[model samples]
Target chain A: MSGTDKILLVDDEADFVSALSERIAHRGLAVDVADNGLKALDLAGQNAYDAVILDLAMPEMDGIETLKRLLDLNPDLQVILLTGRATLQQGVEAMKLGAMDVLEKPARLDLLLDKIRKAQANRVLLVEKRNEEKIRKIVDNKAW
Target chain B: MPWSPDPRWRDSDLAFFGAVTAGATHELNNVFSIIEQTAGLLEDWCADPEADVPAGCDKILNVTERIARQVQRGTELVRRLNGFAHSADEPCCNQEMNDLLENLLALMERFAAQRRVRLVFEPAGAPVTLTTRPFILEQAVFLAVSAALAGTAAQGIVTVQLTGGGAGVEITITGAPALPEAELPAAVGAWLGPPLWNLEGRVRTAARAGKYAIVLTIPKISEEVP
Candidate 1:
């Protein structure tokens, strides 16, 4: 629990999300599932997640829209997009939107795990950088 | 003189086919993705030494059932797509309107899902078989439904009903208007033009305060014109 990476898995498919989340948890990570972008947003707002796994096509709000809103909430959030078919243009758009990576659906477990690990590591570095910046700002403003 | 289909119409037809195929394949990918994950989960369960055998067996069985359901879903999607592809085998053929509309609805489901709208097909009780340009008739209905969908807001219902009469069948598509009254005619025309011309069908639209209906009346036997 102390060092486990926590992730939010957002997909509209119940069985897919459940099985993927279970397998991911078995790999020594903590996973929370959301069936839609709105639920994912709620969870992301309330918790500090190392990364987010988002499906491209969903009801109400799509992955691109969700990515924008999530980034608005925390520009430092590491988002890994999953799509059934990731076109070149879509990949470029997602990268431009600050997604950590784009993965095709039916993603190999090992490959997905690798991306998740990288995302977690990258998130930790961002957090550390932010904390150091906070310390530097405080020191610069100190009276003593 | 030989009759050639309008190049623009042909292009639109191809685009429609491509869109349906892409959507169907995407759904198939989702189905397979679930099956793959469920299989992986079962493997993980089996590999756990401390896991109770009986509990693990139950979980494995449950996941197996999930896989079966996904397979069935994938099979049905493929079947529908096969039918849709074969729909172009003949420019004109004998067709049962109910069956044709059902297949179209299933294939167009992805479009409706994207729009967050509901597509309700109310099939005519009796068989409405006709000798006509079946593919063209289907295209016309497809366009009419698309227009209805465009005029419907998110979560709204677009209903398609079939009614057969003396010499033709009437396809009525209705929905709550999300688009302005003045804009609907042009929008409907843009979608329905080529197909309606080929099918020799007539479209009559009625709009009230909240609801609008687009009715397409297609003759039972349409003589293909050169």
Candidate 2:
């Protein structure tokens, strides 16, 4: 939390993902890119990322499946889904499946950053709330 | 509507047109998808109202405009398709060669771009109007163009010229690579005469000055009957 947040970006379009990742990194966040969902899940397991930005229409374990696997590994992980064209149904489905946010492709960099920041903040709040609850329970117990 | 009539004849033409339109639209969709992704990236950058104006904005705008042109090109294709469909309904009519070429060019532009080839249309002295089935004329022109385009390389150019002559109107397609006389596709050379009524044309490979040209000629009429 003190240093720049680490973000995992998954997209099949290399040129698009490369440009986006560079732009996001320019905004002071650490970004690691994976071209497919499987690699993204592998990276998620290997690292504790602040958030994951995923694209839905990819070959071999798409964004939705990737999201499920990432959350399964770290249930508190924050994720944002990226879709192409005007897919409203997929966006809604992504949200229902615990995605922090769903964005249309060719999305503005600022908007993506805003969502990333918000998701990271919420993750921090969730962790802090759990810590506070633990402290309260400890104080009420006689066993140290 | 008649159950007695041959069902194959009823839907065959329609089905072929549909398939051609769908293929063209699918290619157009891919182009649009690239543009959409780039535009989304630009929008992401501009969302920060207070962020310092970046130097990349100009580049993004240029790409977006290019994408817009492609989308417009796609729209023109749909229009051409509608015209082509209507032409089928009125089989025999006065067909404007220039207008038909224009429509064919619009539809084939993206296809040419995809293959990295260039298709150029050169008009003669004046518009050569002929009395014939527009759809049949269109198919002939389309086939000729498709053949010429297929032979050319990605960077090659296929020139289509509409010239006025005493015998009739000559539609010449030059710049196609010379295929060995033996390699000509059997179907293309099988002499499928005038796919439409009142239209007489031939697809033959002629060599002039050591260059091969695929020429198609359709005779023009002076007037139309009531």
Candidate 3:
């Protein structure tokens, strides 16, 4: 709804998260970063975000678990999994578990932004579809 | 299963190597990501059509270029690590000793810098090519450097030299005062002791005045079956 989208970045590497946060901010997006998966979930609970960029190999709770928890809290949440261990099996598993997409490590900033935009677009479509369903159900009840 | 028949030892060794290699590569990836982000920021700044050109853009570009070079160095270190991992399967092979030493130095650069120890490498007359398991040789060198650093004071210099001789290739590590006897961990000594003693080559250490020097001679080929 706002001009700039809100993005939450979660990774164990401090330097990487810091640098990426700065770069995303430069691209006119409001960015919040967490050092690990637990901190990421805490942040997700506190704020509403347009999308979350998560790292797969983290200490406390891994990306898959974190995504599950975040989605349970808000089913509409969009998640992008970023991992250095880009195994085919893991990628497919993430997508099956409701991740918007899986990206490899060292992904270009522009490419990440594009994925985020698509995720956001998908979120909008889902909401619109739900509203349409609600209207159709109301019309059916009135006719009966 | 008998103690000797169990596969645990091999599994543990594989796990240890895998963890170390993965951790090192992950750290290197983080370094590259930071450099990329910094360069992207500069490019964005330069591309701002409405904004005025900032002062000292040239200096920023120079610094970013330096960071890029460091990233390349990190990538090379990872490549060396990959090579080392593959070398485990090859018991013996022909290798350029100088290149191996350089790669080892690069691999340990961050560790040395963190400890404030200077690593100096002085190669012999010409590049010495040898047939050996370079990974094992690298492990020996790493252990020797760690020992030297532990013995040396902060900001001390650890010098590594390679020389060819009648026996084979001699790798020497020289540093400040000898490491304290109590500091030598038994496991490390055990891992290094047999190879240093049983191999045709010899590993010798001597206390000269106050400083210490460790010399390791590795033969061009193993005496074991081909």
Candidate 4:
């Protein structure tokens, strides 16, 4: 992926988040970390990220709820659910709520990077499609 | 065994065991994941050709410290899991209420966290020994705490206070967004009924303004006298 691909890593585990963020940052990606769903939403609202790495289980608002709200803010946002105790039901629920993918805890770094690359590409395509529609509307409204 | 040999009890016991084990194992997994990432970062720093020697050494020290802390956490979790597994060794045994409750709260910490509820235990300051079926007693306490957690709202606190006297011991579990008086019986019954019966324990529920408290009174020396 490009060094400009920025991602948000959300989890309640402080050490885990810090370590993972460092590893991701080391690979030349701009990474932001949030310790809870609320903080994550705040960051997501304020900034644009190529992808979001979210934890499934959190204190108040879980990943599923976060995923819903994140999509509500920007439908094109790509979220990957990473959890320590993931179940099939939870995976389905996340996917149904617009999550790009579900990954279990202690995930392989290479696999996560691959997903992030895909997310960045998907995001670019979505933004381009939305922009194209806007230009088409402008052209239709203009005088000949 | 003084308690009934009903199949339902067996099922309850197994379910509790399974839930606790699964939660603890999940916690251990997180600990391992942190250690793995921290170590990996350290390795990355070492492999970088243009790495800043002094800065890299400092970062390496921090990562090693992080790994050590997580290892200590993992060790503590395993110790508690081991203690929980042995609680069912005998039908009845002498147990210290404070230690037992501490172990239980640790096991249930994840359950409380998932709901954004805090579980606080106030020890009696002295060991309260009771000759009882440890497993049943733990189940009863667990049920009481579970009921309190259900009634509490997000970011609420469920406090378990232990008080022991010459006669017996009292465990008061209180939570906020209290249930109404009428609903208390049903809520408490669903969780504490069978286990409380086996412990020869009596439960008294009270509403304190906006909080509800369930106080479990058990004789210091169980009538079973095993």
**TM-scores for chain A over all candidates:** 0.95, 0.89, 0.86, 0.95
Docking class of 1: medium
Sorting all predicted structures by TM-score, with the top scorer first, yields 1, 4, 3, 2
DockQ of 2: 0.08
Q: Rate the local accuracy (lDDT) of all candidates.
A: 0.83, 0.66, 0.71, 0.83
Candidate number of the best DockQ: 1
For candidate 4, the chain B TM-score comes to 0.88
Tens-digit lDDT track of model 1 for B1-226: 0111123433487766776688899999999899999998877877988656565677677888999999999999999999988888888777888888999898888778877899999999988777677667767776677667666788999999999953788988888977786667656666677777877778888888888888888886645423
lDDT of candidate 4 over A14-87, digit per residue (tens):
99999899889988899999988889889999999999999988888888889999999989899999888888
Local lDDT at B171 for model 2: 77
**Candidate 2 local lDDT, B68-146, one digit each (tens):** 7667765766677787667777756766778777776667665555445788988776776667656666666666566
DockQ of 4: 0.68
Model 3, C-alpha of A112: deviation from truth (Å): 1.7
lDDT of 2 by residue, A4-35 (tens): 38999897666566567756776778999998
Q: What is the C-alpha RMSD of each candidate to the true structure, in Å?
A: 4.6, 11.4, 9.8, 4.5
Select the stronger candidate by TM-score from 1 and 3: 1
Residue B2 displacement (Å), model 4: 33
Query: A1-144 in candidate 3: lDDT tens per residue?
Result: 332278899987665676678778877789999977778888999987888999887754678889888888878889999877656888888888889899887789989999988877877777788899999999999996
After TM-score superposition, what is the CA distance of residue A139 in candidate 3 from its true location, in Å? 8.3
Better of 2 and 3 by lDDT: 3
